[model samples]
Target: MPDWLSLYYEQPIELTHGEGRHVWDAEGNRYLDFFGGILTTMTAHALPEVTKAIGEQAGRILHTSTLYLSRPMVELAERIAGLSGIPDARVFFTTSGTEANDTALLLATQYRRSNQVLAMRNSYHGRSFSSVGITGNSAWSPTSLSPVQTLYVHGGVRGRGPYAHLGDAEYIAACVADLEDMLGQTAGGVAALIAEPVQGVGGFTMPPDGLYAAFREVLDRHGILWISDEVQTGWGRTGEHFWGWQAHAGNGPPDLLTFAKGIGNGMSVGGVVARAEVMNCLTAHSVSTFGGSPVTMTAALANLTHLLEHDLQGNARRVGGLLAERLRAVTAGLGLVREVRGRGLMIGVELVRPGTDEPSPEAAGLVLEAARERGLLIGRGGTGGVALRIAPPLSLTVAEAEEGAELLGQALHAAQDHMTGRRS
Candidate 1:
């Protein structure tokens, strides 16, 4: 593996198998999986519906590319287009979120006839050359060179930025003003302003609701496209809305949107959705051979069906609320915990140096290690790796949420003691 390849835990355990919310390591120790393989396992591990779909599809045929008629692919696309809420929306499937965002950028740039893009500060899109260029996190984006003339904007991270101390209304005005100023500096019309509804890799950070709606007014005036990168916050994971863009309800929807992560329930499924005009901008033929493979499509169809049939979105709202309350209660008054924020199952617990707001990556690491030892698996995020990411599967039951919270509480206290030299 390359040195840059990221892995969790100082001593990563090899997961052998899993069922529902629990997984067993090579040593046969069971763990309650909170991160869901970086939020890819949407429904549950080894779900019978998804597994059966793959099995049944595999028996018939697998690799019929875009050259032929694909029922499963079309079906999945139709469902996504309808759910996306973009009028006359068109869908294009890819193998990952990176490719999905890349395709959205391609369409936006081509349709607008400009290579310039507007991205949020402290945001992460993906690792592809084009995606990396727009990513605002320096830790992830290794290159300064980019295909598009990318301009980083504010209003993504709320509490730590220049406008953090301002009241909500004042902060919104400041961010909107900053955005107007940034646009004035741009030489030509920007192709699009792409954003993650919740900056996932930037540590589940997000701005006040409707911040994007305010920016939408500016984009609309300049005829610049708004692209919501819902790769992490999509599929009702946020609970309040199916799509993250819906949080900014004043604006109808974005011109373009990208989705991946949980849609396939561990299957490699991703795609871009846009109004017909934007999606059809590509002149030449473009196809992804392995993108809409029957096997993957079947898995996605089944997984999506299960998600809706079970009303897992409601499950996310109810169980996630309980989990959030538990987390806030446990970490309250702790010197190392800065804030507890996030919606639904996508929660982030920001850690700071004891008695200070400065990010404490060391404390976060200790909490992660302690949690793992207690048979729990969580994730870490944020620019400085100071946020504990807690996103369990949407299908998580109330009992599992309670159990995970208790274990996490114990881990946090242990981490606090170790950090303060109470434990040697």
Candidate 2:
């Protein structure tokens, strides 16, 4: 209706620009951007160092195909690998998170030579070929869920899940058992177990304790590839760690790690870090033209440097801790909220589902609309669309965080009052 582009949402606003944690409309009205471009721009809009890197790179060579090596690309790749801690890991950059995940999945397939993929019901890795097959977001996968799609999408390996949430230990255990059974049935044909270290779009939450370890144990025994989608949770957003997998590293490292979002400080840069074996499999597996461009690599390098210099990881931990606590208290005693989940800057408010664990999509929508109306920009993600995502820039101030939570609390209150009207 707004005529910017053909889109799916009911109402769309014309946002002009964003800085730090806020954006403005064409009318010059400012609004807080808590959504952070769906969690990709967590470093905030037009970050100085990142912008400088891009501008400087633009003056030089923009890109070169994967056939030739570039210094910045090599340097950034090494940095990514070092932070990743995946032995002898290598990087292959992409322009977006979807492409990164897609490529990672491709590498897994080649390495294991198997077709089966195990994913959570609410997981969202990407939308690219085969990746969509692995993505559990209903919106992106409903039509692709046919029996035929299931086979190819399942990649000739035994397919399973949209498993139970991370809140249930029994369900978590069962998911591991289920994978074991599927692997057993297929005679070890299961190629990979792909998951978000902290499910971002599935609602920013980590699985119960022993969850990752449980899966790791099984996958280890079965020699299954483990892929961690850190698209939305990486770059120190989760506070306790710079990477999501660290939240459960007691289990072991992932075979492959995919990162996007804040890696290049809102610039279009993404990459996958893989162990030596997995890296070898990919180099021998296939190739891409724009995988690693000089321009993007320079920006990524600058971004990483800024993150370290500013101790952004530490900031995220401090501010995010405050944000999470205020969030829990803001929604306290509110019947419309069921829970608040996630770590660091990645937070999710679970709307009341009444008698079930399933969130109330209607309430969530109302909160998004209300937040936007109240000079705050928030968004929803999750199978039920009942999770209000609050992933702001790591540079956000404590004041901004408090203001955001307070506004969201007001909006949630309004949401509860207008729920019936919205439904009608």
Candidate 3:
């Protein structure tokens, strides 16, 4: 593996197995999995329904190219199309989020006949060449060389920006004005605006509600497509809405919506849902050989069924609300804690230096290590990696949420103590 491929912790532990919201490491220590494998294990770990579906499908057939008519693929696509809310929706499967975003970009650029694109500042779409081109996070985008000309827009991160001091309504207006200005400055009709509904890698930061809807009006006038990258925030993770874009449903759905992570419940399943006209814009032949493998589709179908049947979205709303409240109460007096914000199950706790506004990645690292010590696994993000991301499975129980919150509270205090040199 490349040295650039990073791992968590001062000494990373190998997870051997997991069930529900807990995972056991190679050292035989069990930890409550708060991050959910970067929010990929959406429903749960070792979910029996998904596992059984995978086994049953594998017993029947494992591999088949897109040339063949796969029932599972078509069925899953149908389910997604109905759920996607895009009129005359078309679904295309991919093996990962990067490929999904890449496909969306391909469709948008081809349809608009322009390579210029709009992306959100402090956003992360994917890691592929095309996806990276529109990624606004400099830390993630390694090179300036990109296939498309990307013009980044603001309003992704609410608390830390030039317009941070403004209220929600004012903030939205400012971002909309900024976007209009950028669009006017652009040379030609831009292909699309790709954004993470809630920035995953940027410390789970998000704009105020309805920010995208405001931008949609401007894009509509220019015939620019809106691509909502819901890789991390899809499938009812946000709790309040089934899809993140639904929060901004003042306008309808986006032209393209890319989803991955959690749909397969650990299986590699990703896809793009777009309006038929935009999706069919590709005049050339295209197919994902391993994109919608029967086994993965089966797993996704079973996983999705379980999610809906069990009303995990409602669970996310109730339990995530409790968890966030608990965390806020615990971190309220802590000087190192800046803010705790998020919706549903996806929450971010920003850490700053003691008695200062400066970001403290060191404090975040310490908190991660401390959380591990207490048998809780979380995640880190943000431009400077100063925010702790907590996103457990949608099936996370209220008891589990309480347990994880207590453990995290202890971890936060421990991190603060370590940072202040009160603990040697």
Candidate 4:
């Protein structure tokens, strides 16, 4: 490591190799990988097809501009459009979830012809300038809330889509009203409402049932598009959902659906599925080259084939439910746990102080470290960074998931013991 290079967070142990859910540290210690590359490695580590595809593709063509076009790229786009469960949708490839967010945001702006967006307070979209502006977080960089100021708090409306803009979901409406007021008095027009269908990085938060239905009605009335950021929740990772939006009640679909992670199965690929009407705004626009290489798209195509062939989406639901139930049962006695939330495998264990009611972030870190040392690897999340992110590969076995949960229980108890020893 360079001397001037700042450690982003905790120092990560060097792993020599990984296969399935197990990882071997440089020192030869084995760890069960509950993190699963932040929920990207859906097929698990060192997946056979992924390795073969990479080796074969790397040996072949690597890059070619979209202008020239490529078979694999076009084929993969067709696959995405077809599997995206959207009719007459178009696909635009990108390099990461951030760029996907950027693409969706751009499309939303064009769709509503407005300057505002609506997002939830606990939402986590991405870290780009515009995405961050709509991303509701205090520490999400200074640019997180800088784009529209008061107006950014509201949503856009150009055509019919999802919306209620009232009651509990009313904040989205308040945002809409704010945008309407701002547009009437100032700049005018609201662009879109972008959010994670299931807030993966934001503590695996899930909205109420039928929420999207009401939201859709509202957006339709306002003419603002619904952009679902499925970077972490897409594919079979969330079990029953092929698309994250389906988990919530909604009619029809999102104007733009963003994807990364599972679609690439850890490959550096991301993109957006846009409704033809919304995507039409880009026809006259010039391409600045965000498209993926032939090799990357080939890998994505292979991954998609694998996902459907194995029916991994259904597996995600079955195994994830089994594991979450086990963990929730074991953690039920803990005083430091606030709640265990989220659907499928994208679970979160929110931490709070036992008695004082303040979150015990240090305690959560201790548990995570203890779990790592005891042959399991888990990560943290949430606003205070105290969430135990227990998402594993969608392909993880029921036995493996149970084993991971058991180890996490042991680690939590061990952390509690350490605190007791210190207090005594």
Candidate 5:
């Protein structure tokens, strides 16, 4: 593993197995999993539906590539197309979100005949070379070399930018103005503007509801495709909508969208959906070997079936609402907690220097370690790792939600006391 690869705690605990919302470590200690392996375990850990599908499919056949017809792949694609609102949408499977975004970038650039792209400030698309070029967060983007020239636009985050202090109406107006000005400065046409409806890796922060709808107008005028990176926000994780893009529904659907990380329930599965015209823009032949494997497709089909049949979206709304409220109430009086933000099952708690807006990355690290000690596992992210990311399995029960919140409260108090004593 790379030295830069992060472990959850100071003493990393290896997980042995999990069921529902709980997992056991190698030491036989159990934990209430709150991050769901960075939101990859969408439905639950070791869900029988998904395990059965994989078992049944493996018993039949395994390594047939895209050269042959695949019923599971075709069926999964059909269901995804219906869910994706792109007009005459075409689905192309990939193995990860990085590949999905890479494909989306390819489609947009070829369709528009331009390599220049617009991306939101503080947004994270993926880790691949092509995807990293458009990433707005300098922390996550490791290199300056790129295949495309990217213009970072405003509105992914509205809490600490040039337009942070403005009211909602004013913030929207300012971001839209910034977009217009940025477009005017471009010497050539842009291929597309890719954005995450809710900025996921950037502390799970969200812009005003209509920010993207407003940006969509400008992109349309310039013939720039709109690509929504729904890797972290899709599959009804946001609770209020099926897809994150629906939050900006006033602009209708995006021209292209990419998804991954959750649909296969720990199995690697990802793909891109685009309008038929854009998707078919590739004149050259292309194929992904492990992308639409029968095993993965079967798992995805079963997982999607489980999600819809149980209406986990509704569960996310009800349980996530309770969790968020409980979190806010527990941390309200703590000066170290800056804010509790995000929607539904996906949430971020930002930490700061007590009484100031300055980020406290150290405080976040302490809290993360403290949470692990309490047998609670969460995630840390943001430009400086100053936010605690909370995204548990959608199948989390009401009791589990309350228990996790209580554990988190204890963790926060412990973090606060430690930080204070160290300062003194």
Candidate 6:
């Protein structure tokens, strides 16, 4: 592994296997998995339907390129097109979210004939060259050299920003005005605005409801395309809405939407859904050799079917709501907890120094270590790496939610005690 490849915990354990919301390490210690492999295991681990589909397809065939007409690929594309609200929608599958965002950028820049783009502050799109160009989080973005001249806009993070003190309506207006100012300063026409509905790597932070809707009005005026990067927030993870952009559904859907991470249930499935005109704008020959392989498509189709048939979206709404409430109650009196924010199952507990607003990555690290010692697996992320990110499978039960919350509470208290020099 590269030196930059970061691993969790002071002592990381290798996971051997997982069933539903629980995974066992090589040493045979079972843990309640709260992070869900960075929210990739959407429905559950080792879901029978998805496993069976993968096996059935693999037995038949696996590596038929896009040059061939694969039934599974076409079928999955049809399903996604219908799910995507863009008029005359088209779907193009990639192997990961990075490629999906790259394709979206390709389409947007090609259609608009401009390389200048707009992204949100404290946002994380992906690791690819093009995707990194639009990332606002400095930690993830390794270099300043970028193919696109990305001008970052604001309103992605609600509680921390220049307009954080403003009321909800005022905050929206200020962000919109800032966007207008950015547009005015642009030398030429900008290609698009790419943003995450809820920033995943940026500590799962999000704007108030309808913030994107307000920004959409501004983008529309300048004929700028809107790309909703739903890599983390897609497929009912947010609970309240199937797509995170629906929270800002003042206008219709975005011109393009990129998705990955959960749709394949850890099986490398990603794609971009766009209006026909935008998707068809590419005149040059292009194809993803392993993008929509029959095996992966079959897995995605089965996983998506299970998600819809079981009403996992509704489950996320109900169970995630309960989990969030439990977390808030547990962390209410903790001075190290800066804020507990997020929607549905994608929740973040940002840690700060005791009795101060300063972010405390050390406190977050302690909490993660404590949670692991107690046989609970969560995640940590933020601009300063000071937030605990909790997102279990959509099929997480109420009992599991209660158990995870209790474990997390104990972990929080332990970290607090350690930080205050009262280790026990």
List TM-score per model, in order: 0.98, 0.89, 0.99, 0.88, 0.99, 0.99
lDDT of 1 by residue, 65-91 (tens): 877889999999999999999999999
Which parts of model 2 are misplaced by more than 4 Å?
1-10, 145-172, 282-286, 353-358, 420-424
| RMSD to the hidden true structure, all candidates | 1.1, 4.2, 1.1, 4.9, 0.8, 1.2
Tens-digit lDDT string for candidate 5 (6-65): 677778888999999999999999999999988999999999999999999999998698
lDDT of each: 0.92, 0.76, 0.93, 0.74, 0.92, 0.94
Model 5 has an lDDT value of 0.92
lDDT of 6 at 62: 85
Candidate 3, run of 10 with poorest lDDT: 415-424
* CA displacement after TM-score superposition, residue 5 of candidate 4 (Å): 8.1
Superposition error at 224 for model 4 (Å): 0.9
- Name the runs in model 4 displaced over 4 angstroms: 1-11, 144-187, 283-285, 288-290, 420-424
Backbone collision count in every prediction?
0, 5, 0, 23, 0, 0
Quickly count the clashes in candidate 5.
Answer: 0
Model 3's alpha-carbon lDDT is: 0.93
Tens digits of lDDT, candidate 6, 138-240 = 9899999999999988898998879999999999999999999999998999999999999999999999899999998988989999999999999999999
**In candidate 1, how many clashes are counted?**
0
Judging by lDDT, tell me the better candidate of 5 and 6: 6
* Stretches of candidate 5 exceeding 4 Å from the true structure: none
Off by over 4 Å in 1: 422-424
User: Which ranges in model 3 have alpha carbons more than 4 Å from their true place?
Assistant: 422-424
**For candidate 4, which ten residues in a row score worst on lDDT?**
152-161
- Structure candidate 1, residue pairs in collision: none
The TM-score obtained by model 4 is 0.88
